[model samples]
Structures are given as C-alpha cells and as structure tokens.
Target: MSLSLEKILSEIEQLTPEEQLTVMGYLVELVKKHLTQAQPKHKWSDLKGMAPYPLLSEDAQEWVSRTRREADEHRERLLQGEE
Candidate 1:
C-alpha cells in the first residue's frame, strides 16, 4: 500500500470502536449511492424504433379492437358455462 494509505489506515485504527463502525457505515452508503446513480435513465423516445410501423402483420388499432372483442366473447362463453 502507499504511504498515505498506510498512514490513514493507522489513524483509523486509533479511533474508538463506535467511530470505526460509523465510518464503515458511511463508506457503504457512499458506494450504494454511486452505484444507484450510475444506471441509465430512459425516455419515451428511446423506444421509438423498438417496435417498427404496424408492429405486427395487421393494423395496430384494428388488432387492438379485434383482441378486445375476442376477449369479451371468451369471457361471455365462460360466464355462461359454454366453454
């Protein structure tokens, strides 16, 4: 280790037990904050090209309506014990 680090370590060793624990806890929190801030922050535009036009073989609005209708029909069948 470097001389400066060795000196600092010696100083830390001379502290009371409670002070050492406090320093350790502070260092842990510092590392946690750094890691949390290092992650990327995404925006709506980030997903702009994730799904291209039409998204599927059919029109997006038409596909959504068709799926909703099918779900309602399936629910009715189940409700009437017709499944």
Candidate 2:
C-alpha cells in the first residue's frame, strides 16, 4: 500500500470506537454518492418491452392474483393447525 494510505490507516486505528463508527458512516455515504454518480441514469421509457407479455410464461396480473390467493390459503391452513 501507499505511504499515505498506511498513514491514514494508522490514524484511523488510534480513533476511539465511536469516532471510528462516525468515520465509517462518512465513508459509506461518500461511497454511495460516488456509486450513484457513476451509474447511468435511465428513463422509464427505456425499460419499455424489456420483458414483453408471457416473459415468465404467465400473465403478470394473473400471476400476482394466483400467488396472493395461494399465500392466503396456506396461511389459513397454518392458522388452523393443518400443515
């Protein structure tokens, strides 16, 4: 590692736990900002037809409704002590 990095690491090591946590939170926010700036921005229209109908071999609304019904039935059975 570079001398500057080593020096910074040494300095960080001397910080109290609370100070270290504060520094860590600052670093995390900096990293998040960098990542957001680096990513390409996309408009909603850009995702159009990305997954056309039947992409999952089922209609989206039907799949959603079917899954909800199945989940409710399972939960009802579990509440009734019927595995």
Assess every candidate by TM-score.
Answer: 0.60, 0.51
TM-score computed on alpha carbons, candidate 2: 0.51
Question: Tens digits of per-residue lDDT for model 1 on 16-77?
Answer: 99999998999999999999999978999988888868787788899989999999999998
Q: Give the per-residue lDDT digits (tens) of candidate 2, residues 35-83.
A: 9999998999998989877877998899999999999999999989953
**Weakest ten-residue segment in model 2 by summed lDDT:** 47-56
Please, what is the whole-model Cα lDDT of each candidate in the order they appear? 0.92, 0.94
Report the Cα RMSD per candidate.
3.7, 7.6
